[model samples]
Target: MPGPLRWLLFAVVLTALPVTAGVLVLGEGEPDTAPPETAAPAYSSTPLGDLDTATVALARAPFCDRIPEEAVAEALDGKVGPTASYDAGQAAELAPGIKDVAHEHGCRIAGPGGTEVRAWVFVPPVTRDRATDLVTEAAGREGCSRATAPAYGDPSVALLCPSGKRTWVSFRGLFGDAWLACSLSAPSRLAEQELLDRTGRWCVAVAQAASVVE
Candidate 1:
């Protein structure tokens, strides 16, 4: 995906793509913690590094077959501080610090707090086209802290916090279409800076995964 026209085409393709049975329906202005049973299943279960023929077709299925670098870049731009680079293979590889960071922050290892969070990726075909959006958790209704978009804003990529506490970051290429909301519980031991660093790096990996050739 490259430019606007291509993006538009990709959007159409996305719209036309079959909505999976596992996808949960999210109303606008919902919180990011909504149950997955209600969200839409946006991507297939293809292996991350191996881009098979079917996987490539899925990646290329966007309406215009455009490179949506602009959309992706914009969403990721303002979210976090500087990030280290990781190719597709590396993106799948978790950083050693992730565990330490999560543990230090009081987040559970695999339980509610510090475990590996499941994620999905939306690869729009063009820059001008709307980038796909999804969240680590489902979207929820607005409350004391923040408000969710009127409808399911994006279904391709999302950022999330599992605790009940409130946190927000501006993702450069991702913020526009991407939505993020975290759980209210504060981390047990990790510093906020460390948590942000870990999450931020993971997001960068997501962006790169969407662009890199598997």
Candidate 2:
């Protein structure tokens, strides 16, 4: 070959070598080893025996009438004041929902020393998925955290939130296609576990009462 042509070929080969080497290096790069995302915690699937087959409906009279005063007193560890009831319209406004899709019958019982309990049952027109979503969202509130407790319904979530001088305990669960929620507020000095236990008892009582509504 002539000198000029041979030199041109040599230069082209050198340039192609680097390009090929770069391709090979990139092809042999390490695989992605990043950890997988964590999954949500698992919960029990046991249904509440009493509510599993009951025909759940809003109580004809005030829901407070179904809940015995003794139950309330035991749950709060003190005597309770008069119970205030919220009808469907008022309950719809007070409870959170989308376009008032949920019709809830709620009641508030005042307890001694700045403590209180509020319970509500979501009647027909409310879907179970929507109720579960609401419960999950409530558990994710800023100061709220999930707590371990006995399963009340098919599945249940309990949460605790401490605000200012008061601590709030909440429990929500699904019974058949219906759902119910309850919240208790007490002085922050109360033990969190104790509050959770009380809240659970109150929740069970409320659920039992609501399940038998006609």
Best by TM-score: 2
Give the residue spans of candidate 1 off by over 4 A.
Answer: 1-114, 123-188
lDDT of 1: 0.31
Compose the digit string of candidate 2's lDDT tens values, residues 156-180.
Answer: 6888888889898888767666667
For lDDT, the strongest prediction is 2
lDDT of all predictions, in order shown? 0.31, 0.70
Residue 106 lDDT, candidate 2, scale 0-100? 78
Model 1 Cα lDDT, one tens digit per residue, 1-214: 6799899998888876656322444444457895567675543322212322122212221121122333223223332222222222223322223421111011111223322322232232323243332232222313222122212123322223333443332122233332221121224255555444444443343333433354
